[model samples]
Target: MASVDLATSYAALILADDGIEITADKILALTEAASVEVEPIWASLLAKALEGKDVKELLSNIGSGGGGAPAAAASAAGGAAAAAAEAPKEEEKKKEEEKEESDEDMGFGLFD
Candidate 1:
């Protein structure tokens, strides 16, 4: 079952590598020529997803966590990091409030 999926994927990649347009028919033909039986739907889905997209650029961006332009992604990541840093401060405030509630439950406040 997995082999069939992999075969279709490989066929699409091969077409992309060779600078050929990937399509459902081409994928199906490649898989058939390689003696690997793959479902038609898989090929169609892969082809649809890759249509009008740069395969090489997509491959190069595999290591990047973001999908847009590199500079935009970098700025977004920086903003995310800043937000993450501020998150701990909010969590600390929550913890302090919880501790105060627990202390009141014990019939004592810090000053008393």
Candidate 2:
């Protein structure tokens, strides 16, 4: 589980650095190509959690601001909870988008 989580995060970082939109399929492909076993649910969950947000900006702020250890930990926990709450809605939207893209890529299902 931890390896899968780390794989997704690394994939996301690489995508962001390359100026690519982070998507579940892309993350999964990366993990799979590397022979990492990642749960689809986890990849999709992360994709949703990161939706509509600037990955670089989000990651850059992770340890920039200074605060007391307790306060910092508290804020981090709160932020994580909020992200979890928002992910479900984004997940639905992402699934719809992925379906549309898949259909478009099929090109009349010539080979499928």
Candidate 3:
């Protein structure tokens, strides 16, 4: 797909999820704010495509479809699944360390 098309679609998704009305104007505004350089036609097409659609339902259905390019890329990269599985353990350890540091109070005070 064209880069403009991709940008417009993602902008539409964000607007929908935020409960904002999806329009070419809104999509263009978002893309412009992000410095995406999208064509006007792409935003208009996405707006029409999303008309009368429930954003939350569409997002849920998209998640359910599963196994797209990201999974394929991870497999191609080798051992990505193992790394991903280890991520939560690393996060838990970091959180525990942070809790311990916060408990020390470091001689700081609310008014100091």
Candidate 4:
């Protein structure tokens, strides 16, 4: 299994390095030429995942955690899921804003 994964990954990298579009056919051809048996689905999934993505740039930026990898930080600060879940409820947001404005007008939050 590990050999199959390595063969497919190397094949994809080779295609990317040569500026050739990576496809399941190309990957399978490379693996077959190298005498490695790989599942077609693995190659297809890899191709789809890498579609429209710059492979070299992706490799270069592997250390940058700018995507959805900050789950722990988001959860620690506050529930990121909760904040996003609230965005769809406009009425709740409006009511909260109205309450805040009214409280401010009553001088309840001025000193605080």
Top candidate, metric lDDT: 1
C-alpha RMSD of candidate 4: 14.9
Best by the TM-score measure: 1
Whole-structure CA lDDT of model 4: 0.87
Name every residue pair that clashes in candidate 2.
none
Compose the digit string of candidate 4's lDDT tens values, residues 1-112: 8998899899999999999999999999999999998889998998898889989998999987665545555576687765764565777889889988999888779569
Give per-model TM-scores.
0.59, 0.56, 0.51, 0.56
Candidate 3 yields a Cα-based lDDT of 0.82
Write the residue-wise lDDT of candidate 1 on 33-88 in tens digits: 99998888989999999999988889887888753455565477897766665776
The lDDT values for all models are: 0.87, 0.85, 0.82, 0.87
User: In terms of lDDT, which candidate is stronger, 1 or 3?
Assistant: 1
Task: Give one clash count per candidate, in the order shown.
Answer: 0, 0, 0, 0
Please write out the lDDT profile of model 3 over residues 22-52, one tens digit for every residue: 9999999998988899878878888888899
Residue pairs with colliding backbones in model 3 are none
Error of 1 at 49 (Å): 1.2
Model 3 error, position 91 (Å): 49
